[model samples]
Target: MGFEKAVMVRNSTACAMEWSIELEKALRPKNPGRRIEAIYQIGLRLEQWSGEPEGTMVVYDMFGLVPGEDRLFANTIFLRLADAFQLGNKRDVKSRALALVLFGCWADFAKDSAQIRYLVLSSLVSSNVLEVRASLFATGCFSELADDFSSVVLEMVVNIVTSSETESVVRLAAVRAFAKMGCTFSNANRAFKVS
Candidate 1:
């Protein structure tokens, strides 16, 4: 029955609001494992809905359901990911990272790009190299919003790339992030000038 409902929600936006409400209830911090599982399920469903208008509406509705100070539930999701990392559970960590990426994409699509970009930038500058790498991957969500973030993001990425104390993998990730953001900014700027 739950599987059927999940499928229904993905296929149509009519029931998304009620379903999202239930899912949000399950996402409360009372049970960490359950919350993680919920986030994973949301990521899977979001993937299924990718590029569809209905899916976009569903994401927008879900974000609306959450309080604004909650950062569209990003804080809750990241807290769970942080806990998984602290436990050194590689599988859980990867799953949570994927979930974060999905959420970031959804946020960008929902026109909340600035908030998600800032969140990713803050994570990248964290002392933990693992968090930095995860944030670098998440930054891809804001590729289209490069014009809004390019300068600050470029400065931060360059700093990471030049810092000798940074891990090799993180530095590489930062380089890639820089390239992606730089290209996006240049393209956007050219398009604006052309228009």
Candidate 2:
């Protein structure tokens, strides 16, 4: 579904509520993953229109349709991908990985959902994936915990920039990410500085 349709459905109220149940059933791993894939695509489309917070919330809420039972692993992978894109990223691989991590963490800082926060944070703290870590670092949720997490992410960005074998583009992206969040690199003798 496109953003237009998602908004229309949300406004429709009847269709939105009905699809909420169907979307949950379709998310079951026992069923074909393609249905979940379709819903994910629809969510992706809606995210493009995220300027409308209510519409974005309505669209994001649809993700709850995926049953939260008997599909931990599959759902984990699925939600990760969803969150990466939803959280926003430039590349496909990075976006997908970030999605998984963010989706896993949504409930942590979300409205009255403690279990989700715990589940996601526990997994995030243990994840070995750099993109996942980066995604969480960049999320709005991370900002609440930023005082606790920024130094770590700053270190990651520094590491990515300093490593000899890292790709130039990746280093550039790290710089961009840091600048986006008001971080700066200070070098005493450098002629040009990025802030």
TM-score of 2: 0.41
Error of 1 at 28 (Å): 0.9
The TM-score, computed over Cα atoms with residue i paired to residue i, of candidate 1 is 0.61
Those runs of model 1 whose alpha carbons end farther than 4 Å from true positions after fitting are 1-12, 51-99, 110-113, 184-195
Which 10 residues in a row give candidate 1 its minimum summed lDDT? 65-74
C-alpha lDDT of all candidate models, in order: 0.56, 0.41
Q: 1-195 in candidate 2: lDDT tens per residue?
A: 686675555322223344444445554433334444645653543243233333234444664433332124334434434443334323334334434434434323231233333333333333345553544444324434443333334455555567676666556655554453333333211213322
Q: What is the C-alpha RMSD of each candidate to the true structure, in Å?
A: 8.3, 10.3
Pairs of residues clashing in candidate 2: 24-65, 80-99, 80-100, 81-100, 83-99, 84-98, 84-99, 108-117
Q: What's the TM-score of each model vs. the native?
A: 0.61, 0.41
- Model 1: per-residue lDDT, tens digit, 57-133? 44546544422432434344444433443443434444445544654556454325444455566677666666678
